[model samples]
Target chain A: MSSTLLRTTPALRGALRASGALKATGALSSASFVRGKATLPDLPYDYGALEPYISGKIMELHHKKHHQTYVNGLNSALETIAEAEGKGDLSKAASVAPLLNFHGGGHINHSLFWENLAPASREGGGEPDGALKKAIDSDFGSFDTFRKQMNTALAGIQGSGWAWLVKDKSAGTLNLVTRANQDPVTGPYVPLVGIDAWEHAYYLQYENRKAEYFEAIWNVINWKTVAARFEKS
Target chain B: MVSLNTVWQYLALQSPLQLHSTMMSGDSFNLIKMGVTTFALPALPYAYDALEPHISAQIMELHHGKHHQTYVTNLNKALESHIAAVAAGDVAAQIALQQVIKFNGGGHINHSLFWQNLAPAGSDETKLEQAKELVAAIERTWGGFDTFKNAFSTALLEIQGSGWGWLTREAGSGGGLRIVTTKDQDPVVGGDVVIFGVDMWEHAYYLQYMNGKAAYVENIWNVINWKTAEDRFLGRSEEKNEL
Candidate 1:
């Protein structure tokens, strides 16, 4: 392996584990062994579970096709990098870093996304209780206001992207941020809740009415999962 | 296209008729050069569907007619306001226009280079001439032509979102060729001269390629105009020597 890949792979795996998204999915094997290959994590619930809010078709395609492609792409990129490294070509390995960021980000984001949602039943779409609720109130004035801000941000995405409710771990405060395309929420914030605004996410059901999709998603948001992410972060 | 000297002359006269005549004669470059700049969308060098199979007609049409046109329009609008802000000495307004200028200006610049960099498959330009010094530079930097192509394609596919992958002549770094990626419509702003660029934006290929960006990147190699790249690389090199 290239010296860079050898040094960076373990650190990247550490960051992915520390991200809490992989842990939330319960699919990541022990960090010691899981270095380069990234597999698609199975959805926490059945495909049809998040019905009415997110249709079975969207869930099935998003997971099996979209997320799976990223997993495949990530593994392929890793293999290419390893091959380049074997030849002692560090620049060739460096060139594929963006592939790593995109595919690895897709895996991490979708893994969190599947867990971040649930059917309206089973504690899916209601107001948060306890500490999570207090944090939301403290961060954005009130839950209603936070919802409004997040919806506006999600709707305003010009192209394929995601809107996130992330926690600034150091400050212990929640912040709303948006990422273009499959970019994962990195840096000081730990992603608490992420809403995929990619057209493929809601286009079949909602069509051009992205605002409606954004509004409906609130009904199926797994706040319990979000709270767990926040607590862990 | 109007020469920079024509723009200087037109600015002195500031005649509406002079401007209209220049524009009617297909000299929009003067307008771009003048502070009253209005950038028109450049006509595609080839047909909308010229590079078929490699790039679908629909993708090319939408990408050029719609996407590129939007950038041209927005860039003109932004520049119009920006000129006024500068005239008024409004520092805040100038600062606020920075993002708009970078996004749209970058889009316009990048897309313009992108269109010229592509040719219909089977173009005579595919085979690099040994006489072309740029070919030697590319070989020296990346070991061989195939290796350079692989590195460029790999870098292009890896872009996380809407961005561009570029083959730039790094004048500051002794005129070597470098592969770089820029997020969004951020033009190659560093001291490098962009020789060729590929749009990694989904709009560039999503209609046909769907999520198969790697396929799109790989296939683009069949249509690249190496002659244009060689010209750009050599042009930058000559300019550096003149300095």
Candidate 2:
């Protein structure tokens, strides 16, 4: 939350200069100078707001502990890459690519996931309408069928993963797919709705009976945000 | 599709050292790697359908052939890359390679133990009498065999994500028995001797048990290779001499 935007803070710049990584040019916009650290975004609603479907405790833990860890991890991985780059250690920076991908995808996935959820009393639940609904019905046959297929995808994940409703960029159609672990939905697809299948996402409330949690989560899905994303994409 | 008995005969004659290393330490990677080595998917001793009615043939086929094989394959690739990185003094590459090695290496190690940790249900090897020393130790720790089983089951069920549950002997001259859990694919490290391990990952039982993890946990006992547990706990005299 501090005003410092660049990763090359005084201490790091000093360290780099001391290591002779920074030559006498003193260039400010060097490619090695990492810009803007990623920070945890504020939840659109209160943690307890999505209660009854997802418990207040679960939401608090998911947001404060789990999602925050991803944020921290993403920032840390980026910082490590920056540090390595500053020290002219491209091999070390490249080695951190997996951590960067995992943590970065986790952050993006959780951020999108939180935005697409709302209280049942608010814009949550019900079916998508307008162009989004029409696209779903066209691509997946119907809204009900799409939901069933997504839920099935959620259940069929072999291990920790995410089931996503993605917008195929070329076809402009909706498709359901699953990604193992924190792998983000990428490659010619823009993720619309991502349902985390990792046990930690629902374990405290659902335990091994994940299907119930899968069913309950629909009650709080914000189709409005999903529509906006669809429209934007 | 080798028969367990046939595999046992082959093991007794030609592969006792490999078997003993896998059963004793779950560190067969080091034992097999005298130089640069490519880890292979170990052949299942029993037929895929051998543990059927408890775990299905489909589950075994995929779990071993597909899932475990992927780990072995990836671990080999990662190790080769790591060797190159080390030669080039690529510190970043070596550091990055650490996680993949652990994940895949632990997968190979754990699955190797997991395969031998089980026998076909109702087999003589499943009987606790085959592991008398371990049972006595379990009783001393938890006061009864059923109690220890219950405790271990609780630990397995309570795992929040993909992981493994293990019964290990603390390292040292007179290490005691303990129940522990490792997240993801982390192996039982710190010199602890893994007597047995239960895979809690969904792939291990989802095809057979689905979300009924409790049922999977309960029935797993029916196939537990207690004799292997005994050998691990007792440090079998012959195996000890070989080591």
Candidate 3:
């Protein structure tokens, strides 16, 4: 609605489509952080802290071991790939491609996943205080409509990846998007919420049944933290 | 009368503590020999029979006793195996097991809370003040309650096979109520963090709604404790006061 909408960098725009003024993660979304270049941050809460929604066992495994593995593998791949490139062994680096994709993806995805995790009981998915709600209402005709749009977008994702609620900084509204594989949501938007679709992220207990898993997780989304993010960033 | 009393006393004597302890001592001996500790199912807050036709006693039995038990059993098994993996010097196996441990473990953990989230068969709430706040918020954002319901129902209606629909608040972008979905095994709390949500997985509704997801979602409207949800939504605001 304002003259500054689309020009606010991809970080401050509208839905990248059903989902708000989508904004992106600045250069973080576009740039590749090599193995040596990055680190997995320690969590504010203990591995067991998110219990009930995500068990202590799951958190321990997901963080200490699984995500750490990605970090370790990422470190290995980047150093090796860089060496290969130095020797002009293009083919060697080419062979190293999957390593980078897999490990790098693991690191990136897990890092993103951590920021999203928090105790919902305390946080309450932060309410949209003002403008975000207003825009959502105007664009989708109501907040409920926006939610429905996001749900449809998430349920539609096939295989592993993510569903995003982004502020399309350009359009200045929230939008829903499904990313294929570990493809980052790199458009002109900022991430507000991301739902992981990796089979490993769920499976096991849910078995081949994904719908049940989807249905159970609604109990824990933290709205309070989200609202704060909207206020500051 | 005296003879009958004597007879009852004699019958009680047959089942005395002395006899019971002597017999049960064998179980202690066996436990000492095997060194296994017992773990029992945690009791539910309400009786299984409490929530009647809305949620059948049979389903609660299976869900709590059978399904939940299986998770606990498997989790313990997985933990034991993980300890073995560490002892046997199989780092790779240990790492591999991590995924299953967490996934199954999380499944067990999440569902336990979920069972409590639902009302046991009987009745529901008016949610008075909370409903008024929520209704006002909805009206401000979407015009009225019907619009919000239609929109929310639309979300519940469109699950891709299995997942959850959340009314989450995201930070930095005004705390607008956002609806989002997550795939199988993926929890909003872990990856996206949900404040509260509706389970759209067929298990949540199959027994009740069958393939009619739309109908199941619509019916849920009657059950939602707006008061509970409102408290959660307002939870963060309370924290700000401390600062």
Which candidate has the top score in TM-score? 1
Model 1: colliding residue pairs: A99-B158
Model no. 3, DockQ: 0.02
Q: What is the lDDT of residue A45 in candidate 1?
A: 87
Candidate 1 residue lDDT tens string, B74-190: 777876775565555555775676566667767777787788778888886644661278778888999997899888888887566668899988866487789999988877754
After TM-score superposition, the amount by which residue B85's alpha carbon in candidate 3 deviates from its true location, in angstroms, is 54
> Worst lDDT window (10 residues) for model 2 chain B?
B1-10
Q: Per-prediction TM-score of chain B?
A: 0.81, 0.84, 0.62
Minimum summed lDDT over a 10-residue window in model 3 chain B is located at: B1-10
**Per-residue alpha-carbon lDDT of model 3 for A117-212, expressed as tens digits?**
677565524345576677567777886676667667666553356777777778877677887655556657667667666544554344444555
Report lDDT (Cα) of residue B187, candidate 3: 42
Complex DockQ, candidate 2: 0.07
Best-to-worst order by DockQ is 1, 2, 3
Model 2, global lDDT: 0.74
| lDDT for B236 (candidate 2) | 65
Over B1-243, each residue of candidate 3 has an lDDT whose tens digit, in order, gives: 012122122222222353244234543243223221122355665677554555546545666786557655765566566556544555566566555554445445445435534554324432435456656766787887788778877876644445567666565447676677665434444222234566665455544444345766766665454654665465532211111
Candidate lDDT scores, in order, read 0.74, 0.74, 0.53
Candidate 2 chain A lDDT trough over 10 residues, lowest sum = A1-10
Order of candidates by TM-score, top first? Answer: 1, 2, 3
* DockQ each: 0.18, 0.07, 0.02
Best by DockQ: 1
- Give me the displacement of residue A199 in model 2, in angstroms: 0.6
